[model samples]
Target: MSGSALKPATELARGNSVRTPNESAEYRRAREQLLAEEIELRRHIERVAELRRALPPGGVVTKNYEFEGEGGKATLSDLFGNKQTLVIYSYMFGPAREQPCPMCTSFMGTWEGKLPDVEQRVAFVFVARSPIARLIAAKKARGWTQHRIYSDASGDYTRDYVSATDADAPGYNVFTRRDGSIRHFWAGEMGPSTADPGQDPRGAPDFDPLWTILDTTPEGRGKDWYPRLSY
Candidate 1:
């Protein structure tokens, strides 16, 4: 659906209402105003998605990056399995960290259950700079049975795609295979440098329901609070 074909957000919002016990007329009016903005926000989100889907061809992948999975050595092309598109989430679980990043763990937790559904359309896997055994251990610790995790033990793939310096930062990258050639498709570009004042770096249309649910509360993703491995 195009934004131009839609009714004015304000006009649509005007017809919506929330009734509550003894709600004042002033409160109701303000609620309606907020509703209008929400409608506009929804439209804006769809517009951004449309723009992303329409992006031109991305750069072709030349490196035959290798990783270690459950079945041993595998190349980038192998990660795609039988699918044409692959989504790799490079988490901040490097050899140096005694434990995986709490934030990354939180993010992966949300996708653990949904991977089965998502894989029906695109091949999805989790990659980390740690050894294959370590990555598997973390998966077991989290009780994640559905996520396909791999180890970029050589750090070649991490340095080239996840981080230029091979830092232990989280990354989200997508690739596509066409005509027997692989190409980098999209990646999460927002990071610490792009974060707004008083907010942490986050992806647009954040895949984590944790933050989304927090956003609906009055606290609004509290300043210092973060997920813990065990709490």
Candidate 2:
């Protein structure tokens, strides 16, 4: 071994292998090694999250945007709801589309069950360009009872945070409301330019459990497959 070489973390892992009838020594060794890597990967994810939290406060939100929800009009400040941090997911459901983007719907569906736990630390909501009634109907149809959907009827917020021309796109924007002022915190900036070959444009440490789960299978997430609204 080279003088500079270090042992892989597998040596330090306490993970054990299953005693399945067909399991082999080689399989145990490989799994134990992967366990060590998984441990390190988890730590790495937290470190990246910490770094993201440490970023200097992002741009100050100058526009006092208003949106329509189930109860009527609500300004950006109203969305903050008692929490200092607010996360708004700009969904890709433009007024012109007969249906919302399947990808965005899939993403939103993932968060439905987790919203209650997530909101304990941060306020969260979904925004789309569709009318309030349309957005509400879709949410109900999807059986998403936890989240509140809103409409950027004027496309003002969508244009400002997502696309300059009001293109149908998905955006993850975070903001901070403090001392009577609100400021942008961060947004998922990864896009086509940052995409690796054969992969879609996605942020590091992909938050989607669906993709993560599919990645563990032999078929993997094929290039053409995507979530559907029905069946």
Candidate 3:
């Protein structure tokens, strides 16, 4: 439904029966106001998703990018399996690094458990600019059983989608296969250039739940702090 056709968020927020012990009138008033803003934020998110879904056909992917999967050598089209859509996460694990980026590891960890549900709708896999053996070893070390890890050994796919220099950076790209033609659907384009003042560049609706959970606390996602491979 359009925003204009719906009731105002403030009016909807006023009908809540939420109450807390020892809460002052001022706190309740402020919370209710915040609730209205939150409702509006949710509506905006829905609108953005609608826009994304309405996009026209993306660029055709003519290059047959090669990758090494757990099974064996495969092409980009092979990653789609039986699904019409494919979601690939370019993991920041290059051959030059001893360990993968902690941030990427943390992000994938959040999705590990949810893959089964997500895969029901689309084929999802993780690709890295490292050897297949190393990628498999990292997956095993993390005790991840469901994540489909692959190696973009030649860096062709990485250079085209993730980074031009084939740098170790996290990338989220979506592709669609329709009528025997594969095309780039969408990708997370937000980066250093898109970052706001005093904040790191992040995907819209923020894919990471860690930051969302921390945002509710007084100590939120502070500067100078990041995830680590191990404690």
Candidate closest to the true structure, highest TM-score: 3
**Predicted candidate 1 versus true structure: per-residue lDDT over 145-205, tens digit per residue:** 9999999999998998889999998889999999999999899999899999988889889
Each prediction's RMSD to truth: 1.1, 3.8, 0.7
User: What are the lDDT figures for the candidates, one per model?
Assistant: 0.92, 0.87, 0.94
lDDT per residue for candidate 3 within 32-90, as digits (tens), equals 99999999999999999999998999999989999999999999999999999999999
The model with the greatest lDDT is 3
Error of 1 at 167 (Å): 0.6
* Between candidates 1 and 3, the lDDT winner: 3
The estimated TM-scores of all candidates read 0.97, 0.91, 0.98
- Model 2 has an lDDT value of 0.87
Predicted structure 2, TM vs. truth: 0.91
Two-way lDDT contest, 1 vs 2, winner: 1
Range of the 10 consecutive residues with the lowest summed lDDT in candidate 3: 1-10
